[model samples]
Every structure is written in structure tokens, then in C-alpha cells.
Target: MTEIKRPTWAISNPLMQQYYDTQWGIELHDERALFEMLCLETYQAGLSWQTVLNKRSAFEDAFHHYEIEQVAQMTETQIAPQLKNEKIIRNRLKLNATVNNARTIVKLHVAGRTFDDYIWQFVDYQPQRLVIQKDENLPAQTRLSVQVSKQMKKDGFKFVGPVTIYSYLLAVGVVNARLD
Candidate 1:
């Protein structure tokens, strides 16, 4: 067997490396997965990716396994105590955004659109692959991300901005930056 070396930004842990290699650049179509990724990415604001990755399972449990309907219906009274939970990010704004984003996810579903569909449409259902030699080459925001952020805000989504949207796009595989 031969060993393969990945880029420096990928954690040395085998599982994290596998996730970065296999899933990070591949386009995802599942609505539930899209919702989960969006929520996680939003919560990732101002936090290290490793922190979110480490607590992903806890987040899944806390957010009802990322079930849109359940999270959508969570009231402040119901979600307030989660801030005390050591499992997930304790930021009030981020927690509230998760609930709010869930409602928006459901609204999109009710409009006969899946979160995957709505999000992927911004890229014309194509992954924007970029050739890069280093992590620093990756952009923090793009015109597409800005447009998407504006539209999402107009649609009443929170915790969304150009930078955040760009992160979401990268996380969900709308953008693939691979050095080739």
C-alpha cells in the first residue's frame, strides 16, 4: 500500500483528512444534509472549524439530529437552556439563528424547493472548482456569495453574510479549491 499526503490545512487525523478529501469538494444534494451543513456553518462563525468538527455529534443531538421541522418549531423557552449545554456553541445569536434558519428551510420546502436546490441554484448547480496551491489563496468572499447573502437576508434568514455564505458554499461543496 502507498501513503498519500494531503494539503497542510487538512488536519492530520485520518477521519478529518478523509472528510476533507472525500466530502469537502463533492456536491451534496440531500435537503436534510444541506440544512445541517448550513446550520453548522452558521454556528462556525468566529470559531475554529476543529471546534465545530469536534462537537458535531453533540450538535446533532441537541438540534434533534438536525430535523428541520423539530428545530423550526423550537421556541426561545425551549432553546434557551441549550445555551448552558457544553455540547454546542453557547452563543445566543447563533442558537437563535439555527432555529430561524430552520423555519426558512421549511418555508423553502413548502415552496416545493429543497434547501439544496435553493442553494445550489446560486451556482447554477455546478461546483466552482479552483486551482490553488495554498489555503491563503482561497477567498473569503465572492460576488456570488454576496448576492446569495443579500437574497437570504431578504428572505429573512439570519447569520448570513458574504463571508458566511462563502463559508457555507465551501462547506457544502459548491466551491472546490483543490491544488492540481
Candidate 2:
């Protein structure tokens, strides 16, 4: 029997391992899923990915499964309770940003643009596989992320800084940082 060699970062935790093996670097073109990852990465700011992954279900439940229209319609009345919810990150700003970001996506849809297209255009609708020798070689942010982050903010998104954008890109497979 032979064991598969995975990046050290992915092997330390079961949840991370499963995410790495199943979801990481896989091209995702679904708008709802992309929104979910963006919000998750936003919540991940100043925290670890494990924490966000652990609370993902709670976030999904709280935000109506990251449905852009549903979340965009979430009023303060609906969102106020989440600040007290122990199951999620419970950051008011991040929660608000989630809803705001959803609204941004909805606006894109209204403008006859798809979040799938908007995001994929950055990579020319192709996944970029990078040659990473080790986990340490993974970059926190790249020029692409910076450009995307700037455009996202200009497009009325919130909490989308370069680092978060970089992580989101990796999560959605625009850029594959897998060790080779």
C-alpha cells in the first residue's frame, strides 16, 4: 500500500484534509458557491481557515445558504440576531459585509453579468496551476489578487482585500497553489 503525499498544511486537520482533497483547487463556476467562499474568506480575515470551515454550516444556515438574493434581502432585523449566535464568527461587520457582498452579486446579475463570468475573466476562464514546492512557498497575495480586490471594492463589494481575494481565488480554483 502506498500513502498519498499531501501538503503539510492540508494534513494537520481532518476538515482541512477533506477540503483539500475534495474542494481545494477545483474549478467552481456556481455563483452561489462563489459568494459563499467570498463571505467565508471575509470572515477568515484575522482568523484561521479552520475556524471558518468549522463554522461554515452555521454561516450557511444563518445566511440562507449563501443564496445571493436571499442574503441580499436580509434586513438588519434579520441580521441582528446573528451577532449573538455562538455557532458562527458573530462579527457584526463581517456579517453585514456578507449581505452587502451578496447585494453586489445580485446587482451584477441585474446588469446581465454573471458572477461566474466576472470572476473567471480574471483568469481567462482557465485555472492556473502554479509550481509550489512546499506549503511555505504559497504566496499570501499575488498581483492578480490585488487587481481583483481593487475591482471588487470598486464594484461595491466589502471586506475584499488582496489577501482575502487571494484566498478566494485559490478556493474557487482561479489559481491553483497545490504543491507539485
Which number leads on TM-score?
A: 2
Candidate 1: Cα lDDT at 10: 77
Clashing pairs in 2: none
Worst 10 residues of 1 by lDDT: 1-10
Clashes by residue pair, model 1:
none
lDDT of each: 0.84, 0.91
* Residues 1-180, model 2: lDDT tens digits: 545457888998899999988788788998899889899999999999899999999999999999899999999999999999999998899999999998999999999999999999998999988767655657789999999999999999999999999999998899987655
Question: Which digits, one per residue and each the tens of the lDDT, describe model 1 over residues 4-111?
Answer: 445676766766787687766567888778888888888888887778888889999989988999999999998988999998899999999999999998898899
Model 1 regions more than 4 Å off: 1-5, 134-136
TM-score to true structure, per model: 0.92, 0.95
